[model samples]
Target chain A: MKEYKLMKGNEAIAEAAIRAGADGYFGYPITPQSEVLEYLMAQKPHERTGMVVLQAESEIAAINMVYGAACTGKKVMTSSSSPGISLKQEGISYMAGSELPCVILNVIRGGPGLGTIQPSQGDYFQAVKGGGHGDYKLFVLAPSSVQEMADFAKLGFELAFKYRNPVLILADGIIGQMMEKVQFFDQQPRITDEEIIKKYPWTTTGKTPNRERNIITSLYLEAIVEEQHNRKLQEKFKRMEEDLMFEKIECDDADYILIAYGSVARICQKSMELARANGIKAGLLRPITLYPFPSKQISGLAGKVKGILTVEMNAGQMVEDVKLAVMGKTPVAFHGRMGGMIPSPEEIVSALKNKLIGG
Target chain B: MTEEIIIAGFGGQGVLSMGKILAYSGIMQEQEVSWMPSYGPEMRGGTANVTVILSDERISSPILSKFDTAIILNQQSMDKFESAVKAGGLLLYDPHGITKHPTRKDIQIYKIDASEEAAKMGNTKIFNMIVLGAYLKVKPIVKLENVIKGLQKSLPSRHHHLIPENETGIKVGLEMAEKIN
Candidate 1:
């Protein structure tokens, strides 16, 4: 029966990390994502809990530091915004190639240049389409509300460690600053660094006392060897495709299904309520996991619903995924407002009503 | 019916804090609520304001096309927000800082020296709380008990001690609103 007072998004992330059995945090300061560093620095998990927290020189160095810690079989994490995330792609690619477990939270912003400091879902393509190089994939988790922001950190960390892969937390500035009521876990995961080292005896920890030499490298001199390694990565990724997420809200008798995610999904929830009041059966299909893309769930909805409409904060990046999922069994359409703008409830209602009346 | 409420003023004038309190109170009293701010670059020294919504059902959007009510803390804020209040909606202005009163005689205006009165009560920053108190007097959207609970939950640790003063400001505001109309 333990409860915590209200918490800011960053503070919640810090607490969630400790609960998720993360061994360390290696990060640098970046706008909109600095609070994550601030939380770990203030608490200094190294002193009390034996967890390491170090601020690196740059995003690249920080992510590389994460790579080093993770290579040693430690559960580690780092955070950055759009610009800094762009810088960490090389390190992320390396980690993915080496099969290391970690988490990365990207509090995205307006992009390309040193855009504004406000929230923007512009990093959707970069996050999903391999921002980091090579033929590796990252498990991406997008949280829209402050409540989800706190809870998903635990899920992200656990999933990453389970699969021995990296998980990305795609959040925005609004979700960062906004405070909300969240329940926290008290039974902390008491994991020791010695135990991780014992389990991962093959880790390259520099001349072990009693073990064969271990070398962690992504480069393979022979093409056949590298192709074999890539085939292994692909096989593991295909297994993850079955573990997709789909949230159905008031869709039992839905005349139309609204597909969206993150904060935009919260907006669509309200739109569904209003549309229903006016006798338009509107429901929601929120993909909590963007990368493992829940195609089967949407495929299941083809005959049960009439139409599928996508509402997004970007130019319908996820809408394309929805289209692939439904595959012309039902007409799939898109309505969106991009570049730091949130489409309102009235606009979504109008869109749904228009489609419901066969507009 | 859906309604949007905007209260704006200087940072220390309690505009942002009270806007949140009123929004939470609206939620407790079983209405849809949203609290938005004009943050980012305009955080310090510049004007701060919040938009609050109260509806019977799910709130579709938090943006404001027009407000059902407006509470002005300063002359500048009054001039800026007066145009956005919906027709026949209530407009409350504090004469303590606002020089240019709202012009429309069609809309209801409650002119009170809330800051001066709060300063007389030992703090001038409660001007926004006074406006919120007066707002509750006019709109009657939520109960007094709910508003008090919301304040207790929202007030940061540093400002928790001023709860009594906030309640006094609310009382004075309600009294002023009753007389000014």
Candidate 2:
């Protein structure tokens, strides 16, 4: 029987990774996300499932460790909060360039520089727009619940391997710290080195006598070769775009639509209800995948709604994407609360009344 | 039935744990629940609070501006959370540290001297259980037996021995809680 227990979102991610047959976890502890590492260490996944759990000296080192493990075709993961995630960007860009498969969890807190430990979606631009210097993108999965936190870890790894690119779990502090009932899966054994070599012939699993040696590096001095590599990466991204995931609520005849994701999406659900009660005809469109963003869906929605209001815990980051999706078909307004301050459903409703309905 | 509650007090007063236990009880009774705490600087001996939602349907926002019930343990929390309780909602509190009582006429207020009751029972750690008992007495959101089971589930196996004493503390609070106008 599957075990059900009360779990914090951070702890759920750690438990889920182990059950998902992840080969290794390399991370540095950061608040609102320290439980991920703490839970992993306490459970001793290394002893239980032969998974490698290592606490690196810094976020940069931790992400690089994930890079090294992922290069060998192993399912590896690393988690951190906003500031630390910022530190991992260079390594992430490197991994994306090398076409390595790995999962990175950013249990996001308020940011810019060492911001508050409270939940924030300020890292939207960073996660979705590619913070690292790159012509590449990370498949960003935004989880709003503890159960989703658990489910996304496994899903993140699967998506990472599917396109041979990095996948990020973009969570906020509220989802990381909140406790809720979560069901756990039985352990799955990690892929053997032989299995890895068989699945990923391009993996650098040591030079073999029978096959050509594989080289995993982002550096290509030849401009032509770099252009070809960039084209290939762009194609992979195009394929990933086919997997645009989102949740649309009460939008069948909605006069106005509220766009949100992660923790803020939940608040928008209540805001939609309040608006409906007041006969404002508001609906919610929650983008589950921030990258390969549900732009197509939003574009379709613009023709049906009078206007769209984008809600976030950042100062209008995702709003830009929403505006692009709407493409001037519908007026897109933005409402945000920054520096760890979460906007309430009431605040959202007021904004809708004053901004969308009034305008 | 959906109950959105806020339990607030000094960090050491078991505010977060009380909400956890209540949330677990809600789960034991087959209800959808979410327990969210005020972490970081506010949790270090300062006024800490947790929002616990128990609903028959899927809960939308775990963070809410208004609550169906506010369990205030200190004066600071009482001052802050009094206005947060919805009209006709329950305001449960311990009389020990509350200097200014809730003045809201629209909300029903109940005073449970849980600190005193716990002291009478010779264990201050059971203070939160007593307050929880008082809450149950006023609202009966979950069954008492389920709450006992919840207490058992919440505590580590090493602390299971304290369950009986916590039950007694709950009983004391149930008997002692008085409605305050």
Candidate 3:
């Protein structure tokens, strides 16, 4: 039987995490995303699926807890808002270097530093370009709707395990706080201890006589060894291009293109409608994955479109990527609002007219 | 059909929950719905508002600048959203704490004294349901049966007993709503 329920994006992620057979969740509460932790605590996944849900002392503690659990091959995750995410960078870097799989959710609030509790995509660079001190990338998924919020919980884990790297779900406050109907998938059973040992030979399980001890550490003492590790990580990231996801709307004969992601993408959809109604022939390109960016697709579209406009909730972060992809083939412009202000559909249309069409 | 609504009031006035119930009602009627709330510090005690969109088609943006209907519960919301309604749209409001009324000539304006009615009914908690009832009477976007089912779905089992009282509040709202040109 298909089950559907009305839920906030934050709540949906928590419920989906449990349904995704997550072995443990370690997180500290922070707004616009505190509901993620609150929902998990209330649902008591510990009682339901024997999934450990712990409220750590701080963001630093929570992320390290995820690091510890993930090293054991347990399906573990942690969530936070922007400031809290900043605190988790070191742990994330360590995990990435160690080649451990884990999920991290950033229900991003406005920030250069706790700027506001409102939604913003300011962490685009931090997420896709790497926030921590390393030459590693976090496979980033940006979900624009509550259904995607629920769907990505499972997908995040799968991609994380597949790449043996941290996967970040970069959502904003609008997508986090908004409520919509979500059809849930069937609950999956938690991976057992024996299964974890069998599936992950690199996991730091108990040492046995039959196999060598599984060591999990980010430390590479020799310079050459570290360089080799870095090269291997780069190769892994390069292969992730095969999994790039994106959506194109009305782009077949579009003269102008609007590129956006996450919550801003939904606004751009309305802008596309408004533009078409005015006989402007505009289209929208929404990138679902921020790390394995849809650069190839954007480059392909750039030749067909006369101009492109990038709309975001931050101050022109993703626009840089769009420009790089277009490669001077078409004029690229940026329209954004910072400190948690959201651009309306009309505003985006005006921006398109002013920056791309009329200008 | 698409109906974009904004419900705004003080924090304790059930603005968010009213939008939630309406979204649930839309779901009951097999409509696509989105509920976006103003979840800032203002929700602690200041003005709170929620945007609810119900449509036969997929909702594009949850955050909207203009609305098809504006359900104002307080004067601040009235001041803010009165001009936000599209021309020929509907403006339904409670005249409880409001001193100045809606003055839009292009839009249809209706007043429902839900706070007073709920006070008369001895339960101020159902005030929002009264306003919701009045809005439904004018708009009729979702069926009453679906609304009752929505109430059932949104409220916990322990509070199901209060559904009848809420239904009565809705009836009172339906009776008391008046359009003043």
Q: What is candidate 2's CA lDDT for residue A111? A: 78
Task: Name the candidate that leads on TM-score.
Answer: 3
lDDT of 2 by residue, A32-67 (tens): 899999999999998888999999999999999999
Residues A304-325 of candidate 3: C-alpha lDDT, one tens digit per residue: 9889999988888999999999
TM-score of each: 0.86, 0.98, 0.99
Encode model 3's per-residue lDDT on B32-108: one tens digit a residue: 99999999777765999999999999999999999999999999999999999999999999888899988889999
C-alpha RMSD over true interface residues, each candidate: 3.8, 1.0, 0.7
TM-score, prediction 2: 0.98
Report, to 2 decimal places, the DockQ of model 2. Answer: 0.78
True contacts kept of 2: 0.65
Candidate 3 local Cα displacement, residue A347, angstroms:
0.5
| lDDT per residue (tens digit) for residues B8-76 in model 2 | 999788899889889889888888999999986778659899999999999899889999999999898
Candidates 1 and 2 compared: the better one by TM-score is: 2
Q: What fraction of correct interface contacts does each candidate retain?
A: 0.20, 0.65, 0.87
